[model samples]
Target: MSPSPSSRFRQQLIVAPAVLGLALVAACSNSSSSTGGGGGGSATLAGDCAEYQPYAGHSGTTVTMFASILSPESDSLQQSWAKFSSCTGIKISYEGSNDFESQLPVRVNGGQAPDLAIIPQPGLLAQMVKTGQVKKPDATTVANENKWSPVWKTYGSVDGVFYAAPMSANMKSLVWYSPSAFKKAGYQVPTTWADLMKLSDTIAKSGTNGSKPWCGGIGSGTATGWPATDWLEEVVLGGQGGDVYDQWVSHKIKFSDPQITGAMQTVANWMQNPAWVNGGFGDVKSIATTTFQDAGGPILTGKCWMLQQASFYEAQWPKGTKVGPDGDVYAFHLPAVNPAIPNPVEGGGEFVTAFSDRPEVRAVQDYLSTAAWADSRIKVPNATGWVSANQGVDKSLYTDPIDQLSAAELTDPTATFRFDASDMMPAAVGSGQEWKSLTAWFAEGQSIQQTARDIDSAWPQ
Candidate 1:
């Protein structure tokens, strides 16, 4: 089966030219007496429904949701709701669309908005809050997010108020490879960025069937160059450290700043090398035309040894392809540049925000915030790419090794994690010039310095 629209659109998030800023409001705080876990709702609540028994009286109410989590993920989430529905009788009607970002405002403006929405971009969430399209999350929900890493709380907050809770997350700092091929070639996983480059040199020189060491593709139709953005983000997180990364995302640092241009040049150092990228596709420019969905294929065919991508890239592999340390395919964390910087995690996730504060909606939100819900989400099952950052979630529940590692990376307290920066910038820049400039830089032979300057110039005044 072809990838779901949700999977495809996951590469791109919508942006708008809103004048509002997140500084305008503060994040919401916990108000409920319940702890991070939803307090038991009913005195008679027992067994699987005990935690949610208190919500039994709210059964007649309905909770409607809008989001971009389509297909297998949506199916598993729906099945995971069995216990919550059984206990609360709150009927859930979720509508997943490829156009959620665009359609959301229309629904709100039309006064036909759902009770909740799974917002993918914090920037967009801030815009919605500014326009009064989103409601503050209740204390119970806030408490749950509070228990997670501060990054989750920060992403869900607009200004000082928290209005959303993290639902699902993925790790982007990964380099996929074939375990069998690596074993045959006597290659070991690199633990540091320097070691990774050294390994790349070895592979390129070994010339396994005259193949290259890396494969990459940035093509994504109108969203082309997003994967390229991921490369820049990963390198920036490593090269400049997280504090600078934060400033860069908020536009406190100009795109033309040395940090950015330096990072872009670092990307050019490898990607622009004819011996490093494009693998079976021929020249470096072919990376501009190769669909990201097809970029990993060369790794499987032994034409390339590695492809840098996010954990979700597991879905792009042919069905039933084995994935593990000993399986046909496996992925290792992209090693850190400076070990003292703490391993930087480049990833993204969905934030659950409410449009309505109805009791039923609150109950649904409360249940979702609980550990029971997080755990159940993985157990409900499908082809496993699902993982949770919830400290309460058990990594063993993830059947796929990729999902397990992704979760571990997210839950790693010492890890320096940052959301995708482009998704957090002003629409005119993030989805506009940043995408255009980077594409031209790689595909059209534009200078990295010129591309950085061009993108900096496009930042909204």
Candidate 2:
């Protein structure tokens, strides 16, 4: 569906020179707790209300939200708040994405939490619900206005109550490459797992003529092993199919299950081979800034043929480079890893959460539910490559062709889209043991069996 007039106009405003100053203000203020739900009134349970016409003229309320590091997505959030304020006359406070995760708990425990929050990790939201620090949506009221997908809704549920609303989602099982290079090398896109491995082998063999086949970087500080974990999960999903991966993430299956072992063994075999990755794969930290930078380096310099990453990687490309003929950039769905399983995509979504029990907090939630607000707030011109999770928004909002393609892939019904398995696991397994163990395996030559055991040990009891 096409974006509304207000959304289109807001997109123009965000790109105007005058609006640049407001961009900083919008991102910083809208993301914090200084904006909505400030006063004292019992939070109302708005049951199954299809459209919330917030009590008119509620100017004193504040809605604070937190998100990850700023990028194109930040522009969308800001525009959303701007539209929300215009519609309901409410103010919003915003903050950096990383700040909220650490700061929210301390403040909530101290009784100074914001009314609303957008957490990137579901495990954190789960903790909030468990501690009674957050409130469940009035199901009758929420169900009336918004219908959520089973995948999105389930992530925010704890004991049958929904605590958060999912915003935007991206497809992760994609490998981006330069079409020009592919054409020059006479390579054909492979559709199945066996064919994909053969393609990689062909690219590797071509490297003898001085072209590297793949661009693999495992560095992101503190999150160093994430890239590798993506490879592992992709392979596992392909090798054992989604059902087994789902069981593993939900803790129904052990990390050391035979299927998982085989997946890890596949990764070990690939990394151990000198041709598959660069020399620094074993030494870099996953979260290190350089890791992201390196992933794009090979492509920019025409050294490597492909880089497998999520849609967000487009924002990280070097300044002034465009995709296609004008720019050497393009992406394809990560080829099926196993011929036996259906080709499903893996990725994650961002959600908005609340810590306040005030009436105005619901107003902010209602505002976010509107397509007008989402269209205006999320279509940042500078962030040309981000795909939105909101259904029926204008595809024209995305300027980059690759972003457009990714968005189309996400909406395909035949494709199975699941959250990144590692990220979906409980924090101990998702962030602590699993991340550290994988990095250790790469850098220190830690045994694969021990790494699997370490991950298994960290699973929540």
Encode model 2's per-residue lDDT on 333-385: one tens digit a residue: 77766766666777666666777656566666655654544565546556655
Q: After superposition, how far is residue 268 of candidate 2 from its true place, in Å?
A: 2.8
The TM-score of candidate 2 is 0.81
Worst 10 residues of 2 by lDDT: 1-10
Give the C-alpha lDDT of model 2.
0.60
TM-score of each: 0.83, 0.81
Worst 10 residues of 1 by lDDT: 16-25
lDDT of each residue in 134-220, candidate 1, tens digit only:
888787787777557786878788887888888878788899999999998899989988999899889888886659999998776
